[model samples]
Target: MNHQKSSVEQQYVLFKLDNEFYGIDILQVETIEKVMDITRVPHALPYVQGVINLRGEVVPVINLRKRFNLPEVALDEESRIMIISIEDMIVGLLVDSSSEVIQLEDADVDEAPELGEQKDNEYIKGIGKNEDRIIILLDLKKILGITDTNEL
Candidate 1:
């Protein structure tokens, strides 16, 4: 199998959070599911909503809004859970909604800007520009603080 991409445009799974658009590498995404019951975990991080029984496999779920310190809103009809794989881990992200996959060219993506703390912005992979839209591409490992420091 050829691992090389057929096109220069990279594809991403787009989701909405707090009305802003965010994208994750499509290759890392397993599936997108509707909002389901989550079992709360004791002493888990504030952003972790809980785990869900996904096909007998318990997958931890995180609230993206909470993870980003955005205002919380009650999950409604449009709510969804994005199941993604990062390295050896599989986790779900509770998003406001997700319904599309987008393609972005290298020239259309800009490096994540240096926010207040450059080190704190590693989770943002880049900013994808498509016409009037701007999608925030994310690095799941950095967002979940799962980067292996041992490799450093």
Candidate 2:
């Protein structure tokens, strides 16, 4: 095990959603792209915005706001699509805006609090404290709805 406590610094790709800052493991991020034309996929989950031709691959995109049940808003110039691959499943996450990448040591992270019995809150991995900022660290596995490990 190469894991160390506070000695290890983990990088997170931060983004804004409904004015709140959120982050995901930097390793899972493939690229950050500007908003592009998306083709809607019928019978898909509500959160799913549909697919895009990323290079030659058709990657599915999801709106973070919809996924979190936040009020929807129009995309602006600062809007971005973060391409992330978790457990061999590659997808694009649409965000209000793209933020800079940040590093946080383990000591800077606190476990996420229990937010009632809502299963949606389970996607939060921890709370990262950076200076005066609070970044909600997200668990991509749960966000991607990957409940079956053996099936993968």
- Measured against the true structure, the TM-scores of the candidates, in listed sequence, are 0.91, 0.93
Provide the lDDT at 63 for model 1. Answer: 95
The 10 consecutive residues of candidate 2 with the worst lDDT sum are: 1-10
Candidate 2 TM-score, C-alpha based? 0.93
Q: Write the per-residue lDDT of candidate 1 for residues 2-108, one digit (tens) a residue.
A: 75655479999999998889999999999999988999999999999999999999999999999988999999999999999988789999999996998998888
Per-residue alpha-carbon lDDT of candidate 2 for residues 73-137, written as tens digits (9 for 90 to 100): 99899999999998788999999997899999989999998878869579999999999999999
The residue ranges of model 2 lying beyond 4 angstroms of the native Cα positions read 1-6, 148-152
Question: Backbone clashes in each candidate structure, one number apiece?
Answer: 0, 0
Top of the candidates by TM-score: 2
lDDT of each: 0.92, 0.93
lDDT of 2 at 29: 96
Q: Kindly give the stretch of ten consecutive residues in candidate 1 with the minimal lDDT sum.
A: 1-10
